[model samples]
Target: MNDEASELKPSPKIDPRLLELLVCPLTKAQLEYDAVAQELISRTAGLAYAIINGVPIMLPDEARDINAVTVAQP
Candidate 1:
């Protein structure tokens, strides 16, 4: 049931070392990468920031809203 277009591949442009410096702007929480989900997860805020092509989407709208309900639905 997964959408092919929704699949986000890790960007060659993103430096792994730089990922260490990227923090969630909302909650200021450390982000962990979910390669399968192709997102950087803010565990505190429960938000998933999309990786578009090779770029990490730092914008708010580009981020997916997440919650227990959404997780359950997904």
Candidate 2:
């Protein structure tokens, strides 16, 4: 398959309600969806949790540290 086709492969869909119910395990803070990256970012915790097959891998060990990713203030 071509790169475009591979990228378009169907991934599991996460429910909006489920997203609303999920919080950062460490901080109990809300998560923002980074759809293109397939991650759930917790700004308060400075972590980005991976979403595998549409299932959020909420484990702290599986999350990437975002301390180096600077956010622009309004």
Candidate 3:
């Protein structure tokens, strides 16, 4: 496949309702979606849960520390 075709391939999309339903496992706080990173960020918990193949892996052990993530400023 051509590079353009590969770039155009659709990525798995998470359901909006599911995003609303999920929370930070450690803090019980609401999560913010980092669509570009495919992660659910929990500022309160200082962790980011990964979204794989449209499924959210909410396990704390599977999460990356939010402090380690560098978000670009708009």
Candidate 4:
């Protein structure tokens, strides 16, 4: 690893390219970025994927659930 690599802090923004490639690991569905919550949400599957310090928490146990109202909508 380079010196700069170690010094790099986690980014708040998810790269457009990276986002395009990212999927909800549980369902393999598309993920929506919630900048305010810093989470990658999968409405289809009712899972809210968290992004801590810019790195995504892909673990199922780490994810939160969406509300009933939010999930009810098409």
6 Cα displacement, candidate 2 (Å): 3.9
Off by over 4 Å in 1: 1-14, 68-74
**Which residue pairs collide, candidate 1?**
none
List ranges where model 4 is wrong by over 4 Å: 1-11, 68-74
Q: What's the TM-score of each model vs. the native? A: 0.68, 0.78, 0.79, 0.72
Query: Per-residue lDDT tens digits of candidate 4, residues 1-74?
Result: 69898678445798788889989888999999998788999887888988988788978788898864544666
Per-residue lDDT, model 3, residue 65, is 93
Return the lDDT, model 4, position 28.
Answer: 94
C-alpha lDDT of residue 71 in model 4: 42
Q: Score candidate 2 by lDDT.
A: 0.91
The ten-residue window of minimal lDDT in model 3 covers: 6-15
Q: Per-residue alpha-carbon lDDT of model 1 for 1-74, expressed as tens digits?
A: 56765565334455678689999998887888877677888888878898877688977667887764633553
Reference-based TM-score, model 3: 0.79
* Candidate 2 to truth, TM: 0.78
The sequence of per-residue lDDT tens digits that candidate 2 reaches over residues 1-74 is 59999888876667889999999999999999988888999999999999998989999998999887668999
Per-candidate local distance difference test: 0.78, 0.91, 0.89, 0.84
Candidate 3 deviant stretches above 4 angstroms: 1-4, 69-74
User: CA lDDT of 68 in candidate 2?
Assistant: 70
